[model samples]
Target: MASSSSLLSEEQFLCPICLDVFTRPVSTPCGHNFCMSCITSYWDNASFSQCPVCKEQFQRRPDLKVNTFISELASQLVSLQTSYCDHSRVLVLFCRDDNTLLCDVCSSSCHARHNVVPVQRAYERMKDELENTEAKVQQMIQERFHKVQSMTESVKQTAERQADGFVSDMQREIKELQRTAVKLRELKQTTDQLRFLQSYSSTSLLPHTMDLSTVSANKHLEMQHFGKSLRKSASQLRVSLDEMNTEISRFSGGTAESDAATLRYMQQYEVNIVLDPDSAHPMLCLSNDGKQVRYNMGAGMWAGQFLNPNMFTSHLAVLGRRGFSSGRFYFEVCTGQKTEWCVGVATASIQRRGPLVRSSCCGLWAIWFLIDKFETFICPGVPVHMGKVGRVGVFVDYDKGEISFYDVENATPIYSFTECSFTEELFPYFNPCDNEFGSNLEPLTIVPVCHVE
Candidate 1:
């Protein structure tokens, strides 16, 4: 057995297709052997059928059969080589930098200057590190899972509480009505007795009719008030729930989880934005969905609705449907490969007619693409040199008096405004500047937040 093993080297049984021991070994017409699965897979990807080892091409696909003798020899060689590293070199050291096994010869040749440790020592260290990482990852997953469970449970509890409140209120109203009905029955009996006494005594004993106004007046008012209050409270709660759901969707899974921290942080103040057609310039065309705006050359002649005084007479601009006077808000806009456009927030009272300044001093805190360059539209506009930005995110903290812009695609900061006092409500401002020779005609699309997976 020793002599046989010494004669059979690991190279003899190694299949060129797999670079490992042959399995279900098959012999080709070229007299070369390979693992059946490996050779088949290789040919599937290759344009022509050929022997991998001899490079001999076959005009017709060659028939292959298992080489039972070579297969048995390979099995025995695999068992014998287990104790020998790579079937020839014995692993005595571990190269820490490369995280690989090394024989004495390999250590001297390849890992000459690397930090080499005993194989057992490196194995123990790596095993310990892997265990710690696994534990930490498990703990993090549990924490997040529990957080989600808790939130779901909280929602259930809130719904239960609201339902109980509604039931109790309804019960109270029913009890009040029951008491009123009893009083009504008692009044009817008293009236019947008085009428009988009056007919017998031949004298008037009761007013023309009983007044029900006193009994029903307060009851009607109470019910109306309860309905209004309950509806208002329910609406507020629904709004809060919807906001939470929006935040949850922003970082659902996959690549979004990789960016969860940032996306979740930003989603706290995410606002649903729509373009306000009333504020659009006459030459600007607003899409039917009200989420897109573009400059139209022929739109200037459509005079039917352009006569409105509030319409932008000269400047190509539009304001968002909603305005923010307090707290924080964020929205994103897509320039859609358009090079010339303007986007940011503007005070509600900015000048909209004739020759107007587009600067912070003029109530506009914005960034614009002017002459093929991006720049902040503050006084003495600061030039911003950046690559093509398909989507731009704008965040505003009204109370803090801060406005910041971001390149959404690259997750990079573009510019910011700070320390200025905001006296009025701010509206999302958009200007798909005039279509310069039809080159800038693409619509500025208001893009929904894209959550990557």
Candidate 2:
């Protein structure tokens, strides 16, 4: 008769190699078992390692994966047999001859001639190991799922933010353009009123006149000479209106911001604008025309960290000077001996930011015209308006009597700061195209902040 445990003992366990019940467990292509992750990694680094099974030579080792399913199944069966035999209340057997073990007296007797000892003590020693391993697998899966789900959600949020930013940028720009239009109407009214007054300036101011310097000191007498002051006020008003108009136009015609892009490092978009006298350094030459920021001589005393007697620069506002493109804008600044000297927009200039700049510099900003060309200067301490790049737009501050740079079409303000010292001479400079001035050595550097769609 066949023994009850004969089949179980013979068919239960598999060779760590071959992955089947131990039937001639010869070594395989690897010294390790049928599951070969270990031996493969070992031989992979060795110069020449023969296969443990057939002693075959391999130039390079291939990737290997363990058949963990078969290993665990066999291991579990062995474990079950370890405690199944009905030998005693608590059975354990150790083979002193081979330093091996058996779970019950039956196992020891079957493989007799080997010294035996109880196995209950050994089994108890490592009872929780298998359960802990299974728990770790579950935990690993959970962690992976969490990472994937959170990553997807974060991506969606970032995309939505970029979209909202673009829309807000667009709406603000449109409002600026409207304000510019309104200001233009007001400016036209004010101009007509003042132009008429200019025509009759001699008659109006003939009754009373006072020097501008004296007017500064004597407030009442200056007020009495309203006629003379009327023409001057009108001229100043015109200049202010023109500055606003220019800013509005510039912001009213700008490009859109780029798509949401992840920038892990500053190297992606950040660029160093350095100047060097030698080796094709960017120069601050005179730009024959106007309409852009360029390099020009400092006529008056202005002190800052950078105070080179013949070096401080301005902007060229011309359309097609030697250093400028016909329609595309560029920089005409200076570079030192490998020294960084940059002049990019504080932020992107694509969206319509008339309102933003207007709010910061003086409020009531607008883009009075299309294809914004106004030179809006931000007051000191005021922040710059953010926007995309390349879009046309403008910004205006009618209430504050200030103008700010903006994308004329999109309406994203390019400038946002407060400037208390900017004078009328710094406004448009007569478009700079009609009259030539300044060198265009290193032109206005325009690094794109957004996609140039």
Candidate 3:
């Protein structure tokens, strides 16, 4: 008899539409399990409703309900998959020395006497640490929210005071104008011409009358002062709000509970990226649809290839046709079994004629994966430790100044470049890397996003 974990495979739990593990799994009338969001999104973008697997058409869209049984099974499978070792045995121990999970075989052979402990014990300790960190983050967020609320109240109070002062001044001016009009009327109705002349010439009555032009100028100056104060207060409030928002985004970006959820959220910003042949290196070959690119070892001998000014003359790299200057956009590249590759976004003004600097300062932000190591292309490349990533997902929040890469297969984040100031449009960048004696001859293919709702 085989164990339950042995009997179950990840592929069985995968949704046919998204080609990923079932999320909110739902069963079709045709007896197929698809991600509820995936199928719904499909029907939403299609002309007719049909079972994607069986191609069976329905007169009306069938209502979808979460398949609880399949959902549980898929959840169990994911847990099992994550806990399994390379030898296909369930991990039961944690090696403190190596900081790795270990199956029975691994414990006895490689990680022997390595400060090993029960997996549960390690999990409990780590869970406590994570909970503490989460509490701290929540406290920080609440504090910022409170600060913003306080600032808002202060701004409101100041605005009210200014408005009240203006109203009071207007009221005083109106009373003075009324009193002056009465005095003029009384002088006009006087029976004695001498008294009328004396009243008209009297400096008290003459000076009591308001200068209309002077009043207008005074009111205008007051309004201008109020306007400036209001604008300054608004500016301060905006800056504070922006800071709070940035903090929130940073906290959320790192603490996302589920990689699947993160990937799904990012998929909403997916863009159709195609390679630009004109910007391709002379030795590089692009597919007809401009969705795939690979290094052609013999292409250097071909003299007929046109080299555009924007073409990369030294590096074995290419850029996407479209450049993004604002908002968020995401694209995925299938590296397949390639041993070496690089993918990310580059500033439109990056130097292309010489050896690429491959760093943020030089306008290139990318992750480079070699045979057994993964790292970013910063000045001193930082190593990334995710294992065996096949498909790479690149997500950019242009306005937030963030560029993140994900291991699409495992739905795990690889690396992120944050707080970057982008001054120009950013183009999707790719480096197939050198063929390296034919070991890395595989083409880098840009695949369509299987959006998960």
RMSD of each: 30.3, 34.3, 28.4
lDDT (C-alpha) at residue 369 in model 2: 16
Leading candidate by TM-score: 3
The alpha-carbon lDDT assigned to residue 402 of candidate 2 equals 38
Error of 1 at 152 (Å): 46
Against the true structure, candidate 3 has what lDDT? 0.69
TM-score of 1: 0.43
Question: TM-scores of all models?
Answer: 0.43, 0.19, 0.50
Higher-ranked by lDDT: 2 or 3: 3
Misplaced by over 4 Å in model 1 are 1-264, 302-306
Model 2: residues with Cα > 4 Å off, grouped in runs: 1-226, 251-453
Predicted candidate 1 versus true structure: per-residue lDDT over 1-453, tens digit per residue = 467668889998888867888877889988998987688778778899988988999996665546779987986776556434553765667777776666788888878999988766765565454345434433433333333333333332234444335434433333333333322222222222212221221122121222222322222232323444444444544443333333232222223222333443464588898999888888889999889999987754556766776677778999998999998888888886685888999888888777567555789988887644678776445577544567788878787677877666544567777666899999999999985634788999888775311
Which 10 consecutive residues of model 3 have the lowest summed lDDT?
A: 193-202
Top lDDT model: 3
Give the Cα lDDT of each candidate. Answer: 0.64, 0.32, 0.69
